[model samples]
Target: MEIPQIPINEKERLEALQRLEILDTPAEKAYDDITLIAAEISKMPIVLINLIDKNRQWAKAAFGINFCESDRKHSICAHVINNPNEITEYKNITEVKEFDKNPLLEKLNPKINYYCGIPIVNKENLALGTLCVIDHKPNQLSDAQKTSLQALAQQVMLLFELRKKNSSLTKAKEELHKQNELLKNFAGTVSHDMKMPLSNMILTIDLLKAQYDKQLDFQGKKHLDYIKQASFTLSDYISSILTHYETDKIADKNNVEEIDVNHLLEEVIDLFHIQEECEINFIEENPVIKVNKIALEQIFINLIGNSLKYNDKNKIIISLNFSKDQHYYYFSVTDNGVGIPEDKKDSIFDLFSIATSVDRNGRKGNGIGLSTVKKLVEGLGGKITVESREGQETSFKFSIQKYSQKKTA
Candidate 1:
């Protein structure tokens, strides 16, 4: 009898098979043990777990067999997949002209009389292989035997899915571990490189001030004062770098608690004593957020200090405002300062990227402040933006996730 050809779209079937990634693999006991159990339960002389590849039948497990493969044109399991969830039974493969004439079957000890096969599927709904039982004498599978074989096929599919999921999860964990190590190494290297030069500058400035204490002429005294100021500026720069590093650590977002916004802003304003000359206008009502306090302080200091840094006016007008809508709390800080240039606006938040020099008080910084602010905001799942028009004014608008009223004291 000639087996009718099952018209299947090869591309679709192969694509489905590829998703499982189980082609041409070594034998797994999950598939092997099911074959053995089926053979013992059914009292069959031979059992095979066959995987139908493109051109061959590959046995994942075989009992009482020497050969590992046979031509696909003569595989009983190939037909088994066409009727999934049901076993295909051929009482005699020898009577089937296609399989009987095959070399492997002709050499069979009991002449390969009966065949039963069930297809194994992975998560992608692909029949990657088959669980089969064979017999030398013609036999029919009982209803109980058929049900048991089907359940065993499901177990084989579950094992394949579990292995695939485990493999993917292991790879992701490894990649994350590698990334964390890189961040730690970079933090260590940057600390060492920055501290050495800062230490030398402080020591040299101290010596210069002592040497010029009493015997210095007017011009010499002026030069010494200049050296002292420059040394102090360098010290501030080193401090800024260290602050940036600390900001990164706390910004991990694990220590978020109910923080009072009004109180925090007042503390920052008082620390700077901006009330003396600089008027701080508040458009804020009481508000609170779940955020790391140190990181929030770092953000406030960097931004407020930035406003004071490049101010052209003797008395600066700074404004603070807050509002809530839906899930986000918005904050804006506007200042009458020397505005940023339109072309270099976007680069202002980049580390070591200074747009134009000369802050409000003519003091310079190491230029990592805005970059640190960006990193901190992102760590807390927030966003920030800056707007400026010529040398007239500049404003920073930012938003953060707010703590619910119940969570606030």
Candidate 2:
């Protein structure tokens, strides 16, 4: 039989194999046991768990085999990895071109006359390795044996998938750690750079007030007041930035607690000094949820503050409602505000994305508020959605998972 040379997706295939992390390790009894069972079931003396590496074939489990590995130049298993969809059978290897010059046939054990190998693949459709049974005699495996071997090959594929998933999760965790570190560093740098200039400006303003107050006319006092207002606005902007940074930091920590959502909303409303202006209504029978309290508070604060700031009417109507799906609890903050445009609604949650407005009032939005809410909801494996028009009603609907009740004494 002629051995066909196939072009593999080498980069993806190698990455898939490495992601399994099963190469060059101590023997696993689970896999070894499978091979042992295959040997018994197939009536073959030699059964091996073989991985196709860059230039070598490595064994994770082997039965009735003295050698742990051999060169991929002459490996039947290497060919099997490339053709994962089907099992490869060889009555003899001497006819195959890839194996004709190999030391395994001449200098090494020439006893291996028959081969049956099955490919092990990951969920990504990348073939990683193979499981095979070999015999000294030619054409040893029966149809039943081939069926059992194929079944066992599926088990091996499952093991590879489990390993690959674990590897991916580990990589993701490491990336998150690195990103959090960068955020912390950025926060430190921004705090120093921004605060110093603001401090200097404040000091200069005080000096100007003392030096020019007595000599100045009413116009000068108005100019001084304008400078003071600008300074205060800058200070508020800085505070907003700091608030954004803290929101991210809190979300990263994910400190969840049992919070009274009603009380929390009330607190935010009171803090806004709009406890009277805004008609705040909530379903108060059991408005409790397990959430990162600070994040939840921030969500309410942002939603309500936006309503109060943007609404043209003297009295703003804000309502908090809750519902439950099979997997999560949904919270909706509905309001009558200067609603967002339909075209720009999709980008509302993007960082530094401001609402398109003809008049951006003294509200001084940092634009990170909605983004923070988005991240927090996603981090908690939840979702957020918005519905709004340009000048009508606006509603923010978000969901969070229902926490399992822990048994307490």
Tell me, by lDDT, which candidate is best. Answer: 2
lDDT of 2 by residue, 54-89 (tens): 888888888998768887776678778777788888
lDDT of 2 at 105: 60
RMSD of 2: 6.5
lDDT of 1 by residue, 294-350 (tens): 888778888888877778887888898888788777788899888889987889889
Clashes of 2: 0
lDDT of prediction 1:
0.75
For candidate 2, the per-residue lDDT at 295 reads 70
Give the alpha-carbon lDDT of every model: 0.75, 0.76
TM-score of each: 0.56, 0.66
Q: After superposition, how far is residue 368 of candidate 1 from its true place, in Å?
A: 1.7
Error of 1 at 26 (Å): 13
